[model samples]
Target: MTQKKPTSRRQFLGQTAAIASASLVPFGALSSRVSAQSPNERPRFALIGVGGNGTRTAPVGQQFADLVALCDVDAKHLAHGNGLLCDGKADLYGDYREVLAQDDIDIVQISAPDHWHTKILIEAMLAGKDAYCEKPLTLTIDEGKLIRKVQKQTGRVVQVGTQQRSSMNFFNKALAVIADGRLGKLYKITVGIDAGGWSPEISVADVPEGLDWDRWLGPTPVMPFRYLQDPKKDTDRNYTNGHTHFRWWYEHSGGKLTDWGAHHIDIAMLGIAAAGQNNDPVSVGGSSRHDVEFKDGVPMQDNRYNTAREFDLIVDFADRDVQINIRHDVDNGILFEGERGRIFVNRGKLVGKPIEDVATKPLPKDAIAKVYRDMPIMGNDRDAHWANFTHSIKHRTLPISDVHSHMKMLNVCHLAGISCRLDRTIHWDQTTEQITGDELAASMMSRPYREGYEIEM
Candidate 1:
């Protein structure tokens, strides 16, 4: 069905001033329907992949939005989540497309596997729904560009679930320091993600019962499930039952690159002020170390998580030298190295330079708004990412981590992963958004989807 297109970004902003001028409308009024009508009766939303992140955030969404639907490939997860639905009246579906078909669902929260992100997001926007998708936005480099195009065409308010953007003490302070030149000529950035173990290779086996294996492997190539087996310990175990083991496989995910990189590198992208504004790395290269594997391993249980145990990737930025690395037990955090000084920021701790220096350093009132055009302001207190999304839905404004901006950030991770695989330096074309010189390596940017799952413009 053809959807009613949203007003252009410029047109929507133009109406905002007039609405504020009206004595009846509030300055930050969000609803498009205007006052005189009850704004509480707003849009309905749905949750897809209600297992890990979705299950946790489902109740919170219901408080702000009408949770009318739930979808998941796993029946167990769906049944469990359905029981907790507010008023216990939400519609449940196994297929995501079924939920997307509903006309009343004005918004959707996608917490599906990495491989399914681009497909479901693009289709949802085409069907007239705003999306809140988890980060490490795309599985491949090209997918990033394509997703951006569809988001622009549909004019949807999409928020990539990189909640750091909503934090004042974390992201806002980091952005403030960098843009104000407190870091002074920002020379290098170091990002580290802690996944905590080595990955051993594994052998393939048969598909198990009670699981829609093919459907779970949507858009990814069919491969024998690999199970992990420890030598000298006789017994066997299965690790392919859920999404926990998904990050190690290249079929559906990009190991740590998309997993932890989605978080840590996302911060690096924000700090360097390159998250939304840039695309196409001028150069890419990295090295990785993988675990060893034996032939006689348990079925579908392979030590073969495809992620590298230790990795380092360097992407040549236009002005600065940017780098992302994966280390064991270093924890997930970002470090910004500048000519003047350095600072390290993470979830639990924020330290760098000196307290007196950082405390005294203040960005001018117009600084934040000036560096990022229409970037979300993380008021004094952080932890408002989800609230920002709900507000944007009502306000007809795009969230801070919108798809267009997210695609650019995701490309950095994609290039980092590709570089690790190649283990050598490669040149890139910014305009065409393709790798130069090496045809075989360039082809690796995006793999062909399996039958019935290909995404096209």
Candidate 2:
């Protein structure tokens, strides 16, 4: 890891500087069509960005839909996905646009990097395909706006890949206590998403064979491909910039802010909303520690991972008298604290007196069900999310993890990034979804799209 030790653990400062889609058609000008799929009818699916997540979720999507196409910018990735989902039988392509052109594909399941999700999803919706995108959905706050707008206009059933929403009885059970007011007016949600890793420096190299480097850049600025030899091994096969570690780079991702923050902060908002509390934050401010020095929120180094390795932010939803403290020093998961009691929940278990009391003093029969948004508990984890997506497609209903709700939670994450990058608190207007009075912070909202790859509408 190429990281320098932090000079001070407690530092408060103020400085600011900061900060996809596709389409042949404008969403406003296009006529949308959505046919209700029969309960048993298998919706055809296209798996884009067939890397680790694409391979994982794409096969799961097959449980509810047929894999009609697999797309990736790299040929090896496409082949890897082909090996996983189909026995080299499904049609494969290097460009996602080609997958959207296939009229038979009904659902485009995206497991792409955060940077590519918006562009692929907007294009898929415009091409008349429902989508299931990976969590943390957007690379920036404005991307969320674009996605929500296009989704509303196209009437597409877009499900974000936030599986924790249905992780067995863990979150649902924990959230039920809050919704039932058993926590006695919860005041804070502390989400500990661990921390980001300081990456070893990577060296620039020529693009590898079978990769459409230009197309892969898509809306991102074109940059030289970078690769690093695995320190523990003697191979340069793993690219620090592309297939595996893009999340660590700020240009391609929001770092850990949007990575794990996408998952934890989401559940925090769900608990807030389920408890009938306002979920939008009024202001966001915090301190963060990064290996690379930042100038006006921009990282100084380009060859190594630059995201925050440690951070603590306060997302104050003043209207509800609640605050979310997102930090790296605590255990990974969410903690709900209030006057009466507190409970902790993660993939492992839901703990605390509230959870234990549920055995003797059981919550209402519909308590956890309500947390499930009244949707019947499907399977578990990713399977449950996929099931819900298919059910919503058939029933013309919203999946549990809808884009609007996801973006709502994601806003907190992006704001945290703003505060971390700038080293100061930024006020937020929940209604307009704007960072008020900070030109540098506001500039972080949307990024420049490369020419010939700009998003339409």
Candidate 3:
């Protein structure tokens, strides 16, 4: 894992520019045919995991592409999604591999569970399709590295679902302010990923007819069907409970650490780098309080939610000039504290004197544009994120949420989760990109895949 010194921003940008230039040649050759094609000749899309987030993000892709197919493990979700997309116009499948095998699909929108993300995404890229994957892109640190390697070999466009990167008032503005040094000599950043309390008891129930229970458990260990009764509907038989509660399990997700932390931590890392601080943290130490008892990081209770309920984590950057504290004391948002001023931001609002002062004293005209890698701002945040993905597909360039930077940011999230699980301080060797001197902590970097579901480079 040993590597050379990190590339400077200037060098990185220069390399990106060269790639962009080469990308144009492929599209340029097709420009004549592109002009002849109708405006409706949009890229064809196939969506996998058409549940909660998938349903919400499908329209964004529809705004720029045509939905040609839908795949889901649950028949109820598949039916609902197909109904939303022009009745039965799009093809339907229960297996994602079938959708990937279609040559007509130019893009794959992945909104599956966190555990299934890495396998599906790697397979999609290998299938020669550009992809737009939802956030917390990898389930583990090893998955992140595998993704980077595959993406490098394929040279395909992949955009992660961290939409805040394109937000106008929140992350974009926060980065602009930091880049301008309005928050001078940034010292500490506090991130709060509030708790959602413990979920009610889940009991074993009859597996619904249309659901592929085995396929749904893809890479995770096999277990009996568990369902939570819907309080509102005592008679409903669709069995929609298991889909909603997977987030609280360690096997399926990193809980709030990777759930909300995915959004806030990505922005926090951007702000840290913008303020001339190191993006990679050299060490992480933390303690977390889980709602369920645990032995060797596995929850003792098998039928209830097990992810951490509350946590207080501290991370020291490579330069030691900036420290990040992740906790549950405040509302879910990021608070950047600096020598000159401080500002806090979340989805609802971006506040504090520093942010407010931007009105009387505006940031540089190119600030937001620069944060977006000089790409022109198009519509709203979601639209802009989608626009970057589709535009990159046509132009053959990298999107804003490209694999390289996303992997680096997700690494921090994994480290925080590991530290919390082990209840000890962990040191990271940036050069080698491995945990230093801690065998048990390092071993958690990856997990064993269920025999048939292994991911190969």
Estimate TM-scores for all models: 0.81, 0.90, 0.89
RMSD to the true structure for each prediction, in A, is 8.4, 9.9, 8.8
Descending-TM-score candidate ranking: 2, 3, 1
The residue-level lDDT of candidate 3 at 401 comes to: 88
lDDT of 3: 0.81
Query: lDDT: which candidate is best?
Result: 3
- Put down candidate 1 lDDT per residue, 91-207, tens digits, no spaces: 877777777666667789898888889988877766667788887678888888877776655556788888777766666667777777777656566777865244445566555
Tell me the whole-model lDDT of each prediction, alpha carbons only.
0.66, 0.80, 0.81
Question: What's the distance in Å from true for residue 182, model 3?
Answer: 0.3
Tens digit of per-residue lDDT, candidate 2, span 1-457: 1112222212201100000233334333433233544445667888888888888788788888788788788888877777777887888766676676666678898888778888888877766778999977988899899888878766678899989887867887778788888888778989999888677778998788988888877788777889867768775656477776888888888888888998989888888887777777888887889889899888888888888899988888855588899999999999999878999998888899988888899899887777887887779888998998877776666789999888888988888988989999998898888999999999998888888776643
Model 3 residue 139 distance off true place after TM-score fit, in angstroms: 0.9
Number of backbone-clashing residue pairs for each candidate, in the order shown: 11, 2, 0
lDDT of 1 at 402: 77
| Inter-residue clash pairs, candidate 3 | none
Stronger candidate by TM-score (1 vs 2)? 2
2 versus 3: better TM-score goes to: 2
